[model samples]
Target chain A: MASAGSMAAAPFWRAAGMTYITYSNICASLVRSCLKEPYRAESASREKVHFSVSKWAGGKPEKPNFVPE
Target chain B: MAMAALRKEGRRLVLSSNPSSFARSAVFSEESCPFGARSVSTQIVRNRMSSVKNIQKITKAMKMVAASKLRSVQTRTENSRGLWQPFTALLGDAPGVDVKKNVIIAVSSDKGLCGGINSTTVKVSKTLFKLTSGPEKETKYVVLGEKGKVQFLRDSKKSMELSVTELQKNPLNYTQVSVLADDILKNVEYDALRIVYNKFHSVVQFIPTISTILSPEVVERESESGGRLGDLDSYEIEGAETKAEVLQNLTEFQFSCMMFNAVLENACSELGARMSAMDNASRNAGDMLDRLTLTYNRTRQAAITTELSEIISGAAALSH
Candidate 1:
């Protein structure tokens, strides 16, 4: 009964999967462009920093000896 | 247990009655004759072509899966970016701070075949190791994911402090990062913690990034109260909580949040890298298949022409 039910729902499952893929792809591109604009401006002036830490502590070292820029 | 037993029984039944497996061995033996050798070679080429086609199908499916996953991961990272900015601004900067000990948190994923994402983090950690030097300079590593763990073990086994691998089994979340943060804070002692991860730039670009979290001493030194009070009193804390204790709790909270963000970014980058890598694999496999099919057709034609010429010459000799 379980196998038969799953088989009957296969097309629905496939459709759901396709919808998910499409939705994510769209969302990703939206976020990417939104992120890219500011990132481009920041990169133009400063090197891209990927690491994140709480800024509550005194921030990064005065002079980063190993800046990968 | 019942499911496992049922699967075993089904597998046994298939193996006992599978005629195709028997026919394959028979074909190999029969095709070893001199007359059938050319045909056998052609058949081998055809088999290879079919296998390559199957692989191409798999890689194409994986590429699609990665593309789908990349979107959600990217969205999560983007949503968290707003929260990240304000907290970082509040912390400000610490200048001329020195470190007694350093901990490097190398973030990566368990899965491979994602281009050079993992290697880039490892390389950055190595570079960090080179830059720090002093009498009290002690460096340790807390690696997330099996790939990073293995690479660190191979390159710098001595510096490895702890490794967590099972985290990548599920989609990354704050709970996981909180647990990790608690473990690092409790077990490790360091003046500064450096997080190394691959920052996603685009579908095709990801760069290794290193961010630092300062310990209380370093923070105190860099903060305004430590002789350079530059608007330190501007923001007042409510209630009767000691500033030190408040900073401690906030540090842990920020660490986990930042770690979660890093994990999300790395996950997105990994998916993007995998999608591109699989796409390339599928294309290469298609090219190979085309070449193999052409070779197989040429071989078959040559065999046919040779047989025809032999038959014609024999007919001519018989008539003479």
Candidate 2:
């Protein structure tokens, strides 16, 4: 009842305070980033964000942008 | 003299076509054409029509773009659904969670012109807000995407806790969504999160969906009231208090997975909606363009016929 991938990843990623989706996506993107030029650009474009967000607390505006990760 | 000649020619044609209603037809024509310069009106219609055609061209292009991107987004959404369904199956989806403190996370897009996807999410969130608030029960809103935030600020300003936007301006990935989920988790601590978003069924169909995730303590209490956690007893745990911590971790992870899945679904639906909306706009523009062109042609022909008749009458006058 134990697969190596599941046994190793499920606990580590869950312990990192992240979900399986995050783990899979980060790994997938990490692999994509390691690829050659055109492919790397193609993969990076899929995850890029182009806008800023503002936070409001009880009708009072706060930070214009939260430093993007 | 020319006036009499033109009247006589018109009467002769109307008499030949419909002998009985000739007088009424002449009177109707007199009443209808009170203004001259029909060519000027036709020119205005022609200009407006060309503008409509330009708009149709742009909408057609937009429709093609949406259609092209839809396949990839749809595939992403389908794959992402797997991430949350397993979690939902494990941790019970408490549909109507009536907790003291609940936060409604409404998902939408940053841009507009994609039909009513955003409004529908907001509507569901607002309706849920109304249902979940009372004397002791506290209900707040955490709006995801800027469109929802603008609507929330319009009237439901006081209830909004956090608003995130610009997530859809570029390509979407799970990492960005997880970051957003973490940001929300850090700021807002509530008994449950009622996540509302649009679910993409197909290109032309998307329905509003709401799923509730309870906090660790609530889930523990829920296990006592009812074993809605169908197969929860099979899993082994070390201690009693540790169960809450496990559930806590599970709840947080579940939130991240759910948010990632929801964002992908919302993006897919947005593109699908844009496709249909732009298509409809293009079709309507084509119809209007056809009608306007027909009107313009008829006016141009009428002017030509009148000029020919005047020439004929003047030639007749010169010969006499």
Candidate 3:
């Protein structure tokens, strides 16, 4: 009876320990993603588009005769 | 010693024999009649300390919320880049496109305490206007958010055509941008539309940027170029009228997509700026609390010393 009771309690303790470990892993991953650079690097690369008016104009426009609207 | 017990019982300890002593003690407890100077100042300092602590709690909570929000805003901005890329590529290096009238859309948020996020966008808009606009350019302004509107009103009230306020009260979405785009298309006529916004570089850095959304005239100019026209020739069109209609729809879609991307980028920058600002505020509040706590302890000690000396001197007089 003593062996049987101890054997049953051992699995319960192991399961509780496993749950705590999983919780800690989730928390650590979240902190790493928020604070680190690799996640930002991927997003930053996707945002690289050269959209500028000065480039489109091929430099600055000359002094056109002032025509007021 | 005889008067000390009365002083503790919420009564003024007026010693008639020593008029000067009465005057001195009276001056100390003028307002808090029973409590002396040291305890009264200590009470005031304690109240200030508690209020500062409450402020610190609020700022810390704000910092956490902004951090969580920055992540989601950054994701949205990244995802929307694909939608605007092809549109910009098709209108690449537009040549001989002279814009007679230009409209600037300054995108900022209504909230103020978020460091230099809004001011940077306003400053960039002003600079762009000065660089590109002339007496003949007929530049108009469409100011978004109260902060940008107030800034523009102070300097360029005549140029401001329409102002949109309170758009940043909630997290912005594509639907709101579509409505704003529709309003602009209906009310404003321009040769080109320029968008000024803050771009999030990092948690601690943001850059004010400007992007021009080309008008149909500019797009037509680009399509006439030999190099770009060859690129456009790859697409098979059934009719000239159908092509014009399709291009018009594409232009509207591109405008909304660009606006959506700009708002998302600005929101992320705002959150990043607020997070750092609140972090600094919480640190400053903590420093104030420390200083106030030190003052409180020193004042209490001084009061204890004074009271002990008074009691000993009174006992000595009695013995004599």
Candidate 4:
């Protein structure tokens, strides 16, 4: 009794072997994209995932660099 | 001469009293009494006044922070509602059902100072636990957030199966929440999953809400049993060999959507509660400040009157 049974044979994302996490993330991003200006920008920024990256040289370890999304 | 010596002793005592120590501050009643160490304790009262002022400042700042965050969080909560409401509309939400395996996911906030948001969920969850617990029935607690976890651990530690804390440190979105939902799904199996969270009503009000997501088999049974899923007759299933497969995927996705909305709404309610809590705290601080200032002034007046009387008595003694 779930919604969208009449539409496509499958939900398409599931047919493509996407996990529920990926499917839901795509749906959420699509929703986020439809928001008005400032809010859209704010949500976009909040969703960004930043990481700290470091590369070791031949001898000592190199300085860590912050990788921005 | 004896009176003069007593005056010197009082001066030495006042000087020896720690001016910035609130722990030694005299109560307002003790300060008003015409007796022991009245002047000595006024300095401690001054210390208490400053500590209260600092508390007022912190609470005021927290209120402002919560106010600012509330707007964005509220917007997101409203948007995420669209994700789960459709699922409820189609599948029909589960009512009070006695199930063999029940998983109760109680959403709570990590930070304190929010009025009864955490306690409300804990209380509701506790009630649910009591109701669903019996000889054949079992209830497992899946508490989300540190606040609820600490309280749940106290008495209901044995019933708790899983706890996901510190989720509040990151921004809440469907992406983040889905991963958590997936993690929960992987770890716990249930016939009926009941999510407990605070439903934001207004600035000063919120309700502890529990929404149920039944398994596909339970859904079919409920639908057959004249539940609200009578609309199931209208829809057709394809691509999947059986209705069970489609319902399975839909149920998992719906769970994620529901959890996402739950986290967002709980966050919004927490902020609203915090704003009001901090506002009340700041107002209480202002009242305390007024009373302390009044006592301090009275203590000052008493010291001045005593000094004047001492001078007059000494002058009279000299004349005699």
Strongest candidate by DockQ: 2
How do all models score by TM-score? Answer: 0.70, 0.79, 0.67, 0.77
> For model 3, how does the per-residue alpha-carbon lDDT over A1-69 read when each residue is reduced to its tens digit?
434433552333233442222333344445555655777664343322221110001122223221111
Mind giving the per-residue lDDT tens digits that candidate 2 earns over A1-69?
224433553455666676544565677778988999998897777665444545667686678675364
Of the true contacts between chains A and B, what fraction does model 1 have?
Answer: 0.00
**Superposed model 2: Cα runs more than 4 Å off:** A1-53, B1-41, B238-241
Cα miss at B241, model 2 (Å)? 9.2
**Residues B112-190 of candidate 1: C-alpha lDDT, one tens digit per residue:** 7687899999988888876654676887777877787678766687677766655655566554455556656766888
Model 2: reference contacts kept, as a fraction: 0.44
Misplaced by over 4 Å in model 1 are A1-69, B1-40, B93-97, B224-231
In angstroms, the error of model 3 at B21 is 33
lDDT of each: 0.65, 0.75, 0.64, 0.75
User: Rank by DockQ, descending?
Assistant: 2, 4, 1, 3
Fraction of native Cα contacts reproduced by each candidate:
0.00, 0.44, 0.00, 0.11
Off by over 4 Å in 3: A1-69, B1-40, B93-98, B169-171, B222-246, B312-320
Grade the docking of candidate 4. incorrect
Write down the worst ten-residue block by lDDT for model 2 chain B: B6-15
Of 3 and 4, which scores higher on DockQ?
4
- For candidate 4 chain B, which ten residues in a row score worst on lDDT? B5-14
Report the C-alpha lDDT of model 3 over B1-320, residue by residue, as the tens digit: 52233223212111134333433343344336354433344555566567667767777888899999889888887787776788778755332345878888999887765888888888988887777677677777877777877787677877776666656544565555655665566557887788889877888988887767776656666577656644765687643334454465556667777887888888888889989988877776676667666766766787788889999999999999
Screening candidate 2 with a backbone cut-off below 3 angstroms (N, C-alpha, C), the clashing residue pairs are none
lDDT of candidate 4 over B1-320, digit per residue (tens): 64354334323323444422322245543456556643535767787678667767777888899999999899888888898888977886765877888999999998877878999999999999888888988888888877987888778877777777667665775566776776678767799999999988787889889989988788777777775776675688655446766677788889988998999999999999989988877776676677778778877887889889989999999999
